[model samples]
Target: MKNKRKILDWMLLIAWMILIFTMSNQPANISDSQSEGAIKVLLLIGIDANSIFGQLANFIVRKCAHFLEYMVLALLYINVAKHYFTKKVVIISTVAFVFTYACSDEIHQLFVQGREGAFRDVLIDTCGGVTLLLIRLGISSIKLLKLR
Candidate 1:
């Protein structure tokens, strides 16, 4: 049963990685429309998505999506890592792999038509993973304090 749980964990991680790859492989226009569609939904909520703000909204939504993708990726990764390593090892490995994957994902984008890789995006992605790391650390610290 424990072995099965580990397999399930890896399957989920692989599936999410595949999803991110597929999204990144989309053509530029399709990707833009995706973020724009999100803005449209926000527009329905009566938010000011005027022409100028629309541009800003698009940028924010796009960057947030990148942040959120790797954030969830890090969360899944740490879960699997905990099963195979010590606390310190898991923390180190989680950040290392998440950052590495983020770098590779951007490189992958460079090959995709209409997609250009940017270092800034990689930083944004790393920040997302770090956000999860920080949150998890805080929770662990609280737990330790309570136990003491």
Candidate 2:
């Protein structure tokens, strides 16, 4: 079971790194006459929902995306720490490490051609990491309860 978890953890880490790299390197698509693409499709749908919901949908999407990003980062963090430490220590350290990465990721965006760092995004990203940790805790608690 331990080895399986470790292997799964590494796989998830690789996937997360790929996602982060892809998202970070994504160029701004700025062409006046350009037609539709997948991002455009999502934007159109999101903007339409935003119009109807008055920012709620947009806020939800942004939060969810941030949360997903951080959850992956947290998993990667936990994976690294588990090899060298206790679960509690691993969780705490991973959260701290991921929070720093979130800050750096935002700051790095400031140098991108059309990107600017926002403190709110950083907070959202951290919240995502925390949220994932809580979920893991919740699952563990539930399992303990079942065992008892």
Candidate 3:
């Protein structure tokens, strides 16, 4: 049963990695269109979607996608690492893995037509990952205090 759970955790991590790669493989135009549609939804809810605001909204949506994707990836990495390491080591290793993968993901984007790798995106991704890890640790610490 323990082995099965460990396998499942690793499988989930790999699945998320594939999903991120698949998204990065999309053409720039296609990705932009998806973000535009999301922005339109925001407009429907009265977001003042004027020309400038519309563009800004689109930009925010795109960056948030990067943030959210890596956030989930980091969470999954933590789960997978817990199977093999102490809690402290899991936290450190998960952050390192997420950061390395974020860099690689940007590099992968460089090969996609109409997409160029940006260090800014990598920083954004890493921030997302680390933020999630910190939040998780905070919650765990709170729970431990409650148990005392």
Candidate 4:
């Protein structure tokens, strides 16, 4: 049963990484269009996506994309790590994996036409990973408190 669960967790983690890679592999124009699609969704909610706000909308959408992808990546990695590692080891392993992959994803972007790798994006990605990890830890801590 444990083995099956671990296998599932790993499968999810790998699938997510592949999805991230696929998104990053898109040319800059395609990527921008995707972001624009997201903004159109926001427009439905009455968010003005024009003028200076247009630029801001694009910036927010792009950065949030970076943050969310890695956030989910961290959650999946942590799910797998918890099955195979002690608490201390899980933290170290998740951070290491998330940071390394974030760096690699940016490096991969460099090869894509009209796309440039940014150290800032890597940092944002790592921050997302850390954010999710901290949230997980907080929830765990609360569970422990409840058990006491």
**Candidate achieving the largest TM-score:** 4
What's the candidate order when arranged by decreasing lDDT?
A: 4, 1, 3, 2
Instruction: State in Å the error of residue 53, model 1.
Output: 4.0
Model 4, 1-148: lDDT tens per residue? 9899999999999999999999999999999999999888877888767554756788788999999999999999999989879999999888899899999999999999999999999899999999998998999899999999
Cα error, residue 24 of model 3, in Å, equals 0.4
Number of clashes in model 3?
0
Local distance difference test, each candidate: 0.90, 0.71, 0.90, 0.92
lDDT of 1 at 46: 75
Question: Each model's TM-score?
Answer: 0.92, 0.73, 0.92, 0.94
Which parts of model 2 are misplaced by more than 4 Å?
Answer: 1-8, 30-48, 55-60
Task: List runs of model 4 lying over 4 Å from the truth.
Answer: 49-52
TM-score: model 1 vs. ground truth:
0.92
lDDT of 2 by residue, 114-138 (tens): 7667888888888888888898899
Which candidate leads the pack in lDDT?
A: 4
Between the candidate structures 3 and 4, which one is better when assessed by TM-score?
A: 4
Error in Å for residue 77 of model 3: 0.6
